[model samples]
Target: MSGITENTKTSGEPSKENPSPNSSDTPDDEKKDDRMFECNICLDTAKDAVVSMCGHLFCWPCLHQWLETRPNRQVCPVCKASISKEKVVPLYGRGSTKQEDPREKVPPRPAGQRTEPEPGSAFPGFGFADNGFHMSFGIGAFPFGFFTSTFNFGEARPTPAARGTQQHMEEQFLSKIFLWMAILFVAWLLLA
Candidate 1:
Protein backbone atom coordinates (compact mmCIF):
# COMPACT_ATOMS: atom_id res chain seq x y z
CA MET A 1 0.00 0.00 0.00
CA SER A 2 2.89 2.42 0.97
CA GLY A 3 4.76 1.71 -2.28
CA ILE A 4 1.60 2.32 -4.39
CA THR A 5 1.01 5.69 -2.66
CA GLU A 6 4.67 6.72 -3.28
CA ASN A 7 4.36 5.88 -7.00
CA THR A 8 1.13 7.94 -7.30
CA LYS A 9 2.87 11.00 -5.70
CA THR A 10 5.86 10.73 -8.06
CA SER A 11 3.61 10.40 -11.14
CA GLY A 12 1.48 13.43 -10.16
CA GLU A 13 4.52 15.66 -9.67
CA PRO A 14 6.34 16.63 -12.93
CA SER A 15 10.02 15.63 -12.93
CA LYS A 16 12.93 17.18 -14.91
CA GLU A 17 12.98 14.07 -17.14
CA ASN A 18 9.28 14.58 -18.09
CA PRO A 19 8.66 18.32 -18.67
CA SER A 20 5.12 19.71 -18.22
CA PRO A 21 3.17 20.53 -21.40
CA ASN A 22 2.17 23.98 -20.06
CA SER A 23 5.71 25.41 -20.08
CA SER A 24 6.26 28.90 -21.63
CA ASP A 25 8.50 27.42 -24.40
CA THR A 26 5.48 25.85 -26.16
CA PRO A 27 4.22 27.25 -29.52
CA ASP A 28 0.70 27.83 -28.08
CA ASP A 29 2.14 30.18 -25.45
CA GLU A 30 4.06 32.03 -28.13
CA LYS A 31 0.93 32.54 -30.22
CA LYS A 32 -0.96 33.79 -27.16
CA ASP A 33 1.90 36.24 -26.48
CA ASP A 34 1.59 37.51 -30.06
CA ARG A 35 -2.10 38.23 -29.33
CA MET A 36 -1.00 40.53 -26.51
CA PHE A 37 0.36 42.95 -29.13
CA GLU A 38 -2.83 42.77 -31.22
CA CYS A 39 -5.10 45.82 -31.61
CA ASN A 40 -7.84 46.03 -28.99
CA ILE A 41 -10.42 47.06 -31.59
CA CYS A 42 -9.60 44.57 -34.36
CA LEU A 43 -8.48 41.62 -32.19
CA ASP A 44 -5.63 41.03 -34.65
CA THR A 45 -2.03 42.12 -35.02
CA ALA A 46 -1.63 45.88 -35.07
CA LYS A 47 -0.65 47.74 -38.23
CA ASP A 48 0.31 51.39 -38.06
CA ALA A 49 0.20 50.79 -34.34
CA VAL A 50 -0.51 53.39 -31.69
CA VAL A 51 -0.79 53.15 -27.92
CA SER A 52 -3.27 55.26 -26.03
CA MET A 53 -2.16 57.28 -23.00
CA CYS A 54 -3.89 54.65 -20.88
CA GLY A 55 -1.60 52.00 -22.46
CA HIS A 56 -4.17 50.16 -24.62
CA LEU A 57 -2.78 49.19 -28.05
CA PHE A 58 -4.64 49.72 -31.34
CA CYS A 59 -4.04 49.85 -35.05
CA TRP A 60 -4.22 53.43 -36.32
CA PRO A 61 -6.90 52.71 -38.91
CA CYS A 62 -9.14 50.87 -36.44
CA LEU A 63 -8.73 53.58 -33.82
CA HIS A 64 -9.32 56.33 -36.40
CA GLN A 65 -12.59 54.73 -37.47
CA TRP A 66 -13.71 54.38 -33.86
CA LEU A 67 -12.94 58.04 -33.23
CA GLU A 68 -14.72 59.11 -36.44
CA THR A 69 -17.84 57.21 -35.36
CA ARG A 70 -18.06 59.43 -32.28
CA PRO A 71 -16.42 62.72 -33.09
CA ASN A 72 -17.94 64.56 -30.11
CA ARG A 73 -17.22 62.07 -27.32
CA GLN A 74 -13.72 60.74 -27.95
CA VAL A 75 -12.64 58.09 -25.47
CA CYS A 76 -10.54 54.95 -25.38
CA PRO A 77 -12.45 51.83 -26.50
CA VAL A 78 -10.77 49.60 -23.88
CA CYS A 79 -10.75 51.86 -20.81
CA LYS A 80 -13.00 54.82 -21.64
CA ALA A 81 -10.07 57.15 -20.92
CA SER A 82 -10.11 60.49 -22.76
CA ILE A 83 -8.08 60.17 -25.97
CA SER A 84 -7.48 62.08 -29.15
CA LYS A 85 -5.30 61.69 -32.23
CA GLU A 86 -3.01 64.32 -30.79
CA LYS A 87 -2.78 62.48 -27.47
CA VAL A 88 -1.93 58.95 -28.75
CA VAL A 89 1.70 57.91 -29.08
CA PRO A 90 2.72 55.91 -32.16
CA LEU A 91 4.68 52.73 -31.71
CA TYR A 92 7.38 52.34 -34.32
CA GLY A 93 8.63 48.78 -34.40
CA ARG A 94 12.25 48.11 -35.37
CA GLY A 95 11.12 46.71 -38.75
CA SER A 96 8.89 49.67 -39.67
CA THR A 97 10.23 51.88 -42.46
CA LYS A 98 9.69 55.56 -43.23
CA GLN A 99 8.18 54.66 -46.62
CA GLU A 100 5.02 56.44 -47.73
CA ASP A 101 2.02 54.15 -48.04
CA PRO A 102 -0.17 54.28 -51.18
CA ARG A 103 -3.51 54.16 -49.35
CA GLU A 104 -5.00 57.69 -49.42
CA LYS A 105 -7.78 57.28 -46.87
CA VAL A 106 -5.98 55.28 -44.17
CA PRO A 107 -3.25 57.60 -43.00
CA PRO A 108 -0.13 56.40 -41.25
CA ARG A 109 0.32 56.63 -37.48
CA PRO A 110 0.69 60.16 -36.21
CA ALA A 111 4.21 61.38 -35.59
CA GLY A 112 5.18 63.62 -32.72
CA GLN A 113 5.04 67.31 -33.62
CA ARG A 114 7.92 69.58 -32.73
CA THR A 115 8.02 73.36 -32.56
CA GLU A 116 10.69 75.80 -31.44
CA PRO A 117 10.16 77.64 -28.17
CA GLU A 118 9.00 81.23 -28.58
CA PRO A 119 11.82 83.75 -28.20
CA GLY A 120 11.58 85.64 -24.95
CA SER A 121 10.90 89.39 -25.16
CA ALA A 122 12.51 91.90 -22.78
CA PHE A 123 9.39 94.12 -22.67
CA PRO A 124 5.95 92.43 -22.73
CA GLY A 125 4.19 95.65 -23.84
CA PHE A 126 6.64 96.38 -26.69
CA GLY A 127 3.98 95.71 -29.35
CA PHE A 128 1.54 98.37 -28.07
CA ALA A 129 1.71 102.19 -27.74
CA ASP A 130 1.32 103.19 -24.05
CA ASN A 131 -1.86 105.28 -24.62
CA GLY A 132 -3.02 103.88 -28.00
CA PHE A 133 -4.85 100.83 -26.64
CA HIS A 134 -8.04 101.32 -24.64
CA MET A 135 -10.60 98.72 -23.61
CA SER A 136 -13.84 99.31 -21.66
CA PHE A 137 -16.15 96.69 -20.17
CA GLY A 138 -19.55 97.62 -18.76
CA ILE A 139 -23.00 96.15 -18.33
CA GLY A 140 -25.91 98.55 -18.80
CA ALA A 141 -29.46 98.64 -20.18
CA PHE A 142 -29.48 97.26 -23.71
CA PRO A 143 -30.75 100.40 -25.46
CA PHE A 144 -28.38 102.75 -23.54
CA GLY A 145 -25.41 100.40 -24.15
CA PHE A 146 -26.27 100.10 -27.84
CA PHE A 147 -26.55 103.91 -28.30
CA THR A 148 -23.32 104.68 -26.47
CA SER A 149 -21.32 102.04 -28.41
CA THR A 150 -22.92 102.78 -31.78
CA PHE A 151 -22.34 106.58 -31.47
CA ASN A 152 -18.74 105.96 -30.31
CA PHE A 153 -19.01 108.20 -27.24
CA GLY A 154 -15.68 109.01 -25.52
CA GLU A 155 -13.66 106.90 -27.96
CA ALA A 156 -11.48 107.78 -30.94
CA ARG A 157 -13.03 106.18 -34.04
CA PRO A 158 -11.67 106.34 -37.58
CA THR A 159 -13.25 109.17 -39.59
CA PRO A 160 -15.80 108.07 -42.20
CA ALA A 161 -14.54 107.58 -45.79
CA ALA A 162 -14.29 110.69 -48.00
CA ARG A 163 -17.74 111.69 -49.25
CA GLY A 164 -19.00 110.38 -52.63
CA THR A 165 -16.11 107.86 -53.07
CA GLN A 166 -16.74 104.17 -53.82
CA GLN A 167 -15.65 103.29 -50.25
CA HIS A 168 -18.04 105.90 -48.77
CA MET A 169 -20.97 104.53 -50.83
CA GLU A 170 -20.15 100.95 -49.73
CA GLU A 171 -20.06 101.99 -46.07
CA GLN A 172 -23.38 103.81 -46.31
CA PHE A 173 -25.01 100.80 -47.94
CA LEU A 174 -23.65 98.47 -45.24
CA SER A 175 -24.88 100.84 -42.46
CA LYS A 176 -28.41 100.93 -43.91
CA ILE A 177 -28.54 97.11 -44.02
CA PHE A 178 -27.41 96.95 -40.38
CA LEU A 179 -29.96 99.64 -39.37
CA TRP A 180 -32.73 97.53 -40.91
CA MET A 181 -31.46 94.42 -39.09
CA ALA A 182 -31.39 96.30 -35.75
CA ILE A 183 -34.93 97.54 -36.23
CA LEU A 184 -36.15 94.03 -37.04
CA PHE A 185 -34.39 92.63 -33.98
CA VAL A 186 -35.96 95.28 -31.72
CA ALA A 187 -39.38 94.58 -33.18
CA TRP A 188 -38.93 90.86 -32.59
CA LEU A 189 -37.90 91.50 -28.96
CA LEU A 190 -41.01 93.63 -28.33
CA LEU A 191 -43.34 91.07 -29.92
CA ALA A 192 -41.78 88.16 -27.97
Candidate 2:
Protein backbone atom coordinates (compact mmCIF):
# COMPACT_ATOMS: atom_id res chain seq x y z
CA MET A 1 0.00 0.00 0.00
CA SER A 2 1.16 3.53 -0.77
CA GLY A 3 2.05 5.53 2.32
CA ILE A 4 0.11 8.77 2.78
CA THR A 5 2.77 11.38 3.18
CA GLU A 6 2.49 14.13 5.82
CA ASN A 7 1.74 16.36 2.84
CA THR A 8 -1.98 16.90 2.10
CA LYS A 9 -2.14 18.56 -1.32
CA THR A 10 -3.57 15.27 -2.72
CA SER A 11 -7.16 14.82 -1.38
CA GLY A 12 -5.81 16.22 1.91
CA GLU A 13 -4.51 12.69 2.54
CA PRO A 14 -4.29 9.72 0.18
CA SER A 15 -5.67 9.84 -3.32
CA LYS A 16 -9.31 8.80 -3.35
CA GLU A 17 -9.09 7.56 -6.94
CA ASN A 18 -8.84 3.79 -7.22
CA PRO A 19 -5.53 2.54 -8.54
CA SER A 20 -5.59 2.06 -12.29
CA PRO A 21 -2.16 1.45 -13.82
CA ASN A 22 -2.86 1.99 -17.53
CA SER A 23 -0.01 -0.23 -18.54
CA SER A 24 -2.14 -3.17 -19.68
CA ASP A 25 -5.62 -4.71 -19.83
CA THR A 26 -3.78 -8.01 -20.01
CA PRO A 27 -2.25 -9.40 -16.79
CA ASP A 28 1.38 -8.42 -16.44
CA ASP A 29 3.77 -10.18 -14.12
CA GLU A 30 5.66 -6.92 -13.46
CA LYS A 31 2.54 -4.95 -12.44
CA LYS A 32 1.68 -7.46 -9.75
CA ASP A 33 4.43 -5.92 -7.60
CA ASP A 34 2.80 -2.49 -7.99
CA ARG A 35 -0.59 -3.74 -6.77
CA MET A 36 -1.75 -2.18 -3.51
CA PHE A 37 -2.93 -4.49 -0.78
CA GLU A 38 -6.73 -4.48 -0.63
CA CYS A 39 -8.49 -4.12 2.68
CA ASN A 40 -10.28 -7.33 3.63
CA ILE A 41 -13.44 -5.55 4.74
CA CYS A 42 -14.01 -3.16 1.85
CA LEU A 43 -12.07 -5.09 -0.79
CA ASP A 44 -10.73 -1.80 -2.06
CA THR A 45 -7.15 -1.10 -3.08
CA ALA A 46 -5.72 0.52 0.02
CA LYS A 47 -3.68 3.67 -0.04
CA ASP A 48 -2.95 3.20 3.66
CA ALA A 49 -3.34 0.26 6.05
CA VAL A 50 -4.44 0.19 9.67
CA VAL A 51 -3.92 -2.70 12.05
CA SER A 52 -6.53 -3.67 14.62
CA MET A 53 -5.52 -4.12 18.22
CA CYS A 54 -5.70 -7.78 17.36
CA GLY A 55 -3.13 -6.99 14.69
CA HIS A 56 -5.74 -7.61 12.01
CA LEU A 57 -6.07 -5.08 9.22
CA PHE A 58 -9.34 -4.61 7.39
CA CYS A 59 -10.96 -1.82 5.47
CA TRP A 60 -13.08 0.63 7.44
CA PRO A 61 -16.44 -0.95 6.63
CA CYS A 62 -15.49 -4.52 7.60
CA LEU A 63 -13.88 -3.55 10.90
CA HIS A 64 -16.61 -1.03 11.66
CA GLN A 65 -19.34 -3.56 10.95
CA TRP A 66 -17.49 -6.08 13.08
CA LEU A 67 -17.16 -3.55 15.90
CA GLU A 68 -20.69 -2.14 15.69
CA THR A 69 -22.43 -5.21 17.12
CA ARG A 70 -19.55 -7.58 17.70
CA PRO A 71 -21.33 -9.51 20.46
CA ASN A 72 -22.84 -11.53 17.64
CA ARG A 73 -19.30 -12.16 16.41
CA GLN A 74 -16.90 -12.67 19.28
CA VAL A 75 -13.69 -13.95 17.76
CA CYS A 76 -11.23 -11.88 15.86
CA PRO A 77 -10.57 -13.55 12.51
CA VAL A 78 -6.86 -12.94 13.11
CA CYS A 79 -6.13 -12.94 16.86
CA LYS A 80 -9.16 -14.98 18.01
CA ALA A 81 -9.83 -12.89 21.13
CA SER A 82 -12.60 -14.51 23.22
CA ILE A 83 -13.81 -10.96 23.60
CA SER A 84 -12.97 -8.82 20.55
CA LYS A 85 -15.65 -6.20 21.11
CA GLU A 86 -12.83 -4.08 22.40
CA LYS A 87 -10.65 -3.04 19.47
CA VAL A 88 -7.39 -1.83 20.95
CA VAL A 89 -5.62 0.09 18.19
CA PRO A 90 -7.21 1.73 15.22
CA LEU A 91 -5.55 0.37 12.12
CA TYR A 92 -4.22 3.21 10.00
CA GLY A 93 -3.57 1.22 6.87
CA ARG A 94 -5.80 2.14 3.95
CA GLY A 95 -9.04 3.71 5.12
CA SER A 96 -9.96 1.43 8.01
CA THR A 97 -12.25 2.63 10.82
CA LYS A 98 -11.03 6.00 12.05
CA GLN A 99 -9.22 5.79 15.35
CA GLU A 100 -11.95 5.77 17.99
CA ASP A 101 -12.35 3.93 21.26
CA PRO A 102 -15.65 2.06 21.52
CA ARG A 103 -15.73 2.28 25.30
CA GLU A 104 -15.34 6.02 25.26
CA LYS A 105 -17.83 6.31 22.43
CA VAL A 106 -20.33 3.80 23.85
CA PRO A 107 -23.42 5.55 25.14
CA PRO A 108 -23.92 5.83 28.88
CA ARG A 109 -24.93 2.51 30.39
CA PRO A 110 -28.70 2.71 30.91
CA ALA A 111 -29.83 2.86 34.54
CA GLY A 112 -30.67 -0.62 35.87
CA GLN A 113 -30.70 -1.91 32.30
CA ARG A 114 -28.79 -5.08 31.75
CA THR A 115 -26.79 -5.60 28.61
CA GLU A 116 -27.87 -8.85 26.98
CA PRO A 117 -25.14 -11.30 26.18
CA GLU A 118 -24.65 -12.67 22.73
CA PRO A 119 -27.11 -15.43 21.78
CA GLY A 120 -24.62 -18.27 22.32
CA SER A 121 -21.61 -17.27 24.35
CA ALA A 122 -19.28 -19.72 26.09
CA PHE A 123 -15.74 -20.29 27.21
CA PRO A 124 -15.03 -23.64 25.63
CA GLY A 125 -17.03 -26.11 27.83
CA PHE A 126 -17.74 -23.61 30.61
CA GLY A 127 -20.48 -21.00 30.31
CA PHE A 128 -21.33 -17.47 31.38
CA ALA A 129 -24.59 -15.62 31.77
CA ASP A 130 -24.25 -15.19 28.01
CA ASN A 131 -23.51 -18.86 27.66
CA GLY A 132 -26.10 -20.69 25.54
CA PHE A 133 -26.51 -23.82 27.69
CA HIS A 134 -28.32 -22.51 30.81
CA MET A 135 -31.43 -22.05 28.64
CA SER A 136 -33.61 -24.74 27.08
CA PHE A 137 -36.37 -25.04 24.52
CA GLY A 138 -40.15 -25.50 24.39
CA ILE A 139 -42.03 -26.75 21.32
CA GLY A 140 -40.72 -24.42 18.59
CA ALA A 141 -37.23 -23.12 17.97
CA PHE A 142 -36.59 -20.16 20.24
CA PRO A 143 -34.05 -18.83 22.73
CA PHE A 144 -35.28 -19.19 26.30
CA GLY A 145 -31.85 -19.01 27.85
CA PHE A 146 -30.72 -15.44 27.95
CA PHE A 147 -28.99 -13.51 30.71
CA THR A 148 -32.15 -13.07 32.70
CA SER A 149 -33.05 -13.66 36.34
CA THR A 150 -36.53 -14.87 35.43
CA PHE A 151 -36.29 -17.99 33.26
CA ASN A 152 -39.44 -20.08 33.48
CA PHE A 153 -39.27 -23.53 31.89
CA GLY A 154 -42.86 -24.45 32.71
CA GLU A 155 -44.24 -22.32 29.91
CA ALA A 156 -43.60 -22.27 26.14
CA ARG A 157 -43.42 -18.85 24.59
CA PRO A 158 -41.14 -16.73 22.40
CA THR A 159 -39.48 -13.44 23.16
CA PRO A 160 -40.94 -10.52 21.29
CA ALA A 161 -37.95 -10.08 18.99
CA ALA A 162 -37.00 -13.75 18.97
CA ARG A 163 -40.51 -14.45 17.69
CA GLY A 164 -39.12 -13.97 14.19
CA THR A 165 -35.86 -13.57 12.25
CA GLN A 166 -32.86 -15.89 11.90
CA GLN A 167 -32.75 -16.15 15.66
CA HIS A 168 -36.06 -17.99 15.54
CA MET A 169 -34.45 -20.55 13.30
CA GLU A 170 -31.68 -21.01 15.85
CA GLU A 171 -34.29 -21.39 18.60
CA GLN A 172 -36.09 -23.94 16.45
CA PHE A 173 -32.85 -25.85 16.28
CA LEU A 174 -32.91 -25.88 20.08
CA SER A 175 -36.45 -27.21 19.91
CA LYS A 176 -34.95 -30.59 19.12
CA ILE A 177 -33.03 -30.36 22.35
CA PHE A 178 -36.32 -29.58 24.06
CA LEU A 179 -38.01 -32.54 22.40
CA TRP A 180 -35.39 -34.93 23.79
CA MET A 181 -35.76 -33.37 27.23
CA ALA A 182 -39.51 -33.75 27.04
CA ILE A 183 -39.13 -37.40 26.20
CA LEU A 184 -36.73 -37.93 29.07
CA PHE A 185 -39.02 -36.05 31.43
CA VAL A 186 -41.98 -38.23 30.42
CA ALA A 187 -39.97 -41.41 30.97
CA TRP A 188 -38.90 -40.21 34.41
CA LEU A 189 -42.50 -39.34 35.27
CA LEU A 190 -43.74 -42.83 34.29
CA LEU A 191 -40.96 -44.48 36.28
CA ALA A 192 -41.87 -42.43 39.31
Question: Using TM-score as the measure, which candidate wins?
Answer: 1
What are the runs in model 2 whose C-alpha is more than 4 Å off?
1-37, 46-50, 67-70, 78-85, 92-192
Cα lDDT of candidate 1 equals 0.64
* Residue-level lDDT tens digits of model 2 in 1-192: 243421211222232333433433556633442343455566665333444554454544455556666656666555676434344343332344564533333443224536655544233333333323334434332234322323542332333234558876677677667768867865775698
Pairs in clash, predicted candidate 1: none
Superposition error at 61 for model 1 (Å): 0.3
lDDT score at residue 30, model 2, on the 0-100 scale: 34
| TM-score computed on alpha carbons, candidate 2 | 0.30
C-alpha lDDT of residue 84 in model 1? 87
RMSD of 1: 17.4
